[model samples]
Target chain A: MTSLLALGILLLTAFLLLVVALLTRNSTPRFREIPALTRLVRTLGLSVEDGKRLHISLGHGSLLDERGGSAFAGLAALRIITEKTSVSDMPSVASAGDPALGLLTQDTMQAGYQAAGVEELYVPTTSRVTGLTPFSYAAGAMHIASNENVSTNIMIGHFGPEAGLLADISDRDYVTLIGASDNLAGQSVLYASTQDALIGEELFATGAYLGAGTSHSASLTVQDILRWLIIITLLGGAAAKFVGVI
Target chain B: MRVLTAVIAIAVGLMVLLGYFFAEFVGIQTLLLNWAVILAGVASLVGIFNLIAVHTDKVRRAEKGGVYSALLVIALVATFVFGLILQPQHQIMQVLLNGIILPVEATLMGLLTITLLYAAIRLLRRRADVMSVFFIITAVLIFLGSATLPTGDVPVIGTLIRPWVSQIWALGGARGILIGVALGTLVTGLRVLFGIDRPYGGK
Candidate 1:
């Protein structure tokens, strides 16, 4: 009950903030640039222009679990990527470990193509369930990344340490890799392996950075406010503990 | 069509969310989740067919890796036939798991260590920034502390510094990241609920 109430409050706060942000959207909002996202956006354009395929590896995360958050974020990123690259000679492809995520990737890609008025060009097989298990997923994705004429590989989702294999393959192939994951070991592996690696909440900001919509930017504000609240609560609790107030 | 899809999605999502707080919604939530599970199972079948189709097309086109695709198709069909006939609990199926799947997965897992080591070396060569140096040092310290020297444990590095770094600093940082991730999840869920973002083929 207490947890429910807390969740309610957080949701309410976020909704209200989102409304405020949407209502006050006359001017362009300024945001501190994320170098990784900046590089990703530039690479998207370059890949399209160079007629090179872009491979997006949405890691093995099911929507039924907590790991689904990053998977959803990855789907959002895929939507944006598909929209941007819909007209390219070599359309972008996405791979997922979970069939549910793969299904959504197909839906998201189709929606993206529909939005771009290129629905006829959308291929359902472009977004595939590459494998069922983690290592198989990484191995399958590595094959796509290395063999598909992919100049840029963007991996965002719930990856484990097995992501290292994907990174190693991308490195060997000289493909530009931008990776992120909600898992700690995955983050560590990606950070060590990839030049541009999003850590923690940065993965969630993919939509906003890639211009998914104003709502994405608004949600980022809510995240920022909630993060600061958490930090303050942590510090206050620590202080109280230090002073034996508990 | 888009509006209808969005309505159904939001309704189902709310029912599931409310199931946590209100007992009345639990029955409906369970029903919906069961349906989702069935759908997911069907989707997996569809995905398998798609995989087969992709490989078949590769073989048909005589692509560069067509031979491997042919092998994969054969292996997939053979395994499916064996599993269907013998059942997964049968000895032959167990042999497939124990002899083939487990060992293959284990070998891949073993490769990760070498991959990570090579990545760390490359990281040092590529970016020797302050954060990179700190990360390398922290990783090294943790590894050293976890290892037992043939003689005994190291002194301060193992006893004091590693404990402080891992227990305090690393834990604190991890918690911070987790909180941020949770907030992000909440916001993303709300966005979907409110129809601001529709990943379900809704406009």
Candidate 2:
């Protein structure tokens, strides 16, 4: 019965997302400014123009688990970043801690290149698995961030407190670091370590904020609607409990 | 090709999702999941080879960190060969794990404490905003609360405030973030299922 209820909710969310996506097909939606993403997008353009590399770290999040959600968002951001910077002297590189994520990142880069009509520029080594363990992953990504002439480091995925190491390198090397994570430890570590850190649901908003597609924006609208619904339900439940109703 | 890939993905995804609620599709879902697990193992091997190839190229080109790359490749290959020969359950493998891997990882974990402190200090120096101040204050209080002096715990901060802050405020905020994250996950999964957003090489 609980599983049924979960499925019902999932179906309802899917319906809402599709409806909102179709409704907003012709209309342009305005999103409130997220300074982190703004700075990231701006840095992306500058990095391309200046012939500096960009490093995206997709942490070791399993594709079969809930953690895969944030990593998928990171992949979407990577696609957009790759497409935009494919023509630059130094193309963007991505690192993943999980094998599935590593392969997917490579595929995403290839798709992005194909989309930009630069399939010849696609390099399989551009996206790879740096390390399997959390600390090792951070260490390897730190090497790339510090040594690859990368101007900006965008870390959006599942990470642990070990992310502080990468952020430390970014700070020491004077490279821009924009990071986010789904894990609480990772979030707290990133929040304290990085100057531009996306908190909570902001990590999921990467695709929408980066102009991935209208469907991405529509997903944001669905998230907003669902958030309000959840808030109302929680408040109502609390009120009922306060009034001696179970 | 993209359409076909999307169809297969969506069909498999729906079957797995439905298998959770209905018993009829559970067999197929399990079969698919097992296949995925096998594929993931192969992918890991592919990733390891890719890592070796990248480092090999670096060493060949004599890049600045080529020495480190060479060391890594040597260590990785040696480890793999030794593990395969002796088996992971062998005493030598256990000693290698306990003496080397575990200690190294533990040391890194210990390093996180200092890194976190340094970051907290840098955060204060970089941004003294309301959120940063609150974060630092809460962290300090939590640390202090968790510690005990020669005599006992601290005064009201430890006795009265810590439990409330951790159990109430922190729990509430974490729950809020979790809900938002769940909603985001749901929408993202839906997008993939509907073929609206494909990160799996689909155009």
Q: Which candidate is the best by lDDT?
A: 2
Question: After TM-score superposition, what is the CA distance of residue B115 in candidate 1 from its true location, in Å?
Answer: 0.6
Q: RMSD per prediction, one decimal?
A: 1.6, 1.1
Q: After superposition, how far is residue A133 of candidate 1 from its true place, in Å?
A: 0.8
Q: What share of the true interface contacts does each candidate keep?
A: 0.69, 0.77
The sequence of per-residue lDDT tens digits that candidate 1 reaches over residues B1-203 is 88899988999989988887788989999999999999989988887887888788879999877898898889888998999999989998999899988899999999999999999999978677898999999999999888899867678888998999999999989988888887888887787777777888634
Residue A32 alpha-carbon offset, candidate 1, angstroms: 1.1
Instruction: Please give the lDDT score at residue B134 for candidate 2.
Output: 97
**Which candidate comes out best when scored by TM-score?**
2
Model 1 misplacement above 4 A: none
**lDDT digits (tens) for residues A104-124 of candidate 1:** 888999988988999999877
DockQ score for model 1: 0.72
Per-prediction DockQ comes to 0.72, 0.79
